[model samples]
Target: MTGAEAVGSGNLVMGRCVIAGKSACVLYDSKATHSFVSESYVQRLGLPVCELQCDLVVSTPASGLELEVILGMDWLSANRILIVCCEKSLLFPNSEEPELLSSHDVMKELQNGAQCFLIFTHLVVEGEGMICVIPVVQEFEDVK
Candidate 1:
């Protein structure tokens, strides 16, 4: 499934997961044929990429998406993971002790970041004078 379709679908589940020891928002999309990670995210995290034997193209909306990763059916079935949509959770049957990953509205967590970027972009586009962004975390002051 396309990212746009997944975002609009009721079957899609949003949750948090750790990737390379960093927190990341993930979308569990049952309709997607294969799992995918954002190219920009991969570059930022310095994750290795393996070229596919055949070409694969993905089409997504031009804007309004901030997805970092998408876990599709291929990964779910291979990992023996079950999606309990009614309860909004994922069950991992392969684990020594069954593990559950509860789903949450990751959008709520990302709203601040999205808003910040959107405002910054708008100001830049409208030439609304010099803009300064002071991040709460000093370490991330240079992030943008």
Candidate 2:
């Protein structure tokens, strides 16, 4: 399922993902209404983490000059997306991919008319769970 469907259905995405040779599934709960990652996950992913329960950052898109976004964990979680009436697909750029972006970067891309697929995520940080909007890269990939 797409991130929107998962969030609307009030479900969590749990499955095994092989990261750095460790078998771990990304367990994402959209109902939490907040997004966060375990310190371990953050460390493993090598993404900058904030100590505050909730935080926002504004970043410029690498591909554009006039966009910025309030990036949070929810915005960072998706992996792929389908747009254009599901006839077209887009991959969520990893840091190495040069297309993966922070919230601000995404906003810039949107403002510039570089459209493919998009999802908005809002994260509420509490307990030990994290909520995120996921992009569907493969048709059969599981979101819950």
Candidate 3:
């Protein structure tokens, strides 16, 4: 199946939310089991974005010591939830493979402080790929 089809199947299976605005289309991949936002759409938003195939496996903190994560529109949709608390760590259950993680984990991590230095190591690309970094908060009050 194609990427879009896989996304559709994943949504059907997981019952995740879909966020499609005039500028973007995002969905959760229940099968490949990763959240994704259309690269093309994100580009239109005037942000420098890059994508490596799921199999490509490009990661930050090549040392495997620093916490790493992949974030995009689809991830935001299912995880639009938020938790306002102090002291927490982000759990990446899907970090190993292609499984959806609980939004609760996202909320806790964001609230507790996830600002750590990141170094992306990509075999195919020259040097480490460091994109723009932005701090995010998942407020439960705004997830309608």
Alpha-carbon lDDT, every model:
0.70, 0.46, 0.39
Q: Rank the candidates by TM-score, best first.
A: 1, 2, 3
Candidate 2 on 38-142: residue-level lDDT in tens?
Answer: 456557667675466866662211122111112234543453321222332223454564455787987888899986465547646798787667676666656
Model 1 earns a TM-score of 0.54
Taking the tens digit of each residue's C-alpha lDDT, what string does model 3 give over 21-100? 34222222223345444445455555577655666543221132111223433553466532222322123333355434
lDDT tens string, model 1, 1-144?
A: 655665686555778889887677787878788888888879879988888899878754314567788888899899888899897789766447633322333355465452211222343435666667755554645546
Ranking according to lDDT, highest score first? 1, 2, 3
Cα shift from native, residue 10, model 3 (Å): 10
Candidate with maximal TM-score: 1
lDDT of 1 at 143: 46
Per-residue error (Å), model 1, residue 112: 39
Q: TM-scores of all models? A: 0.54, 0.25, 0.24
Alpha-carbon lDDT of model 1: 0.70
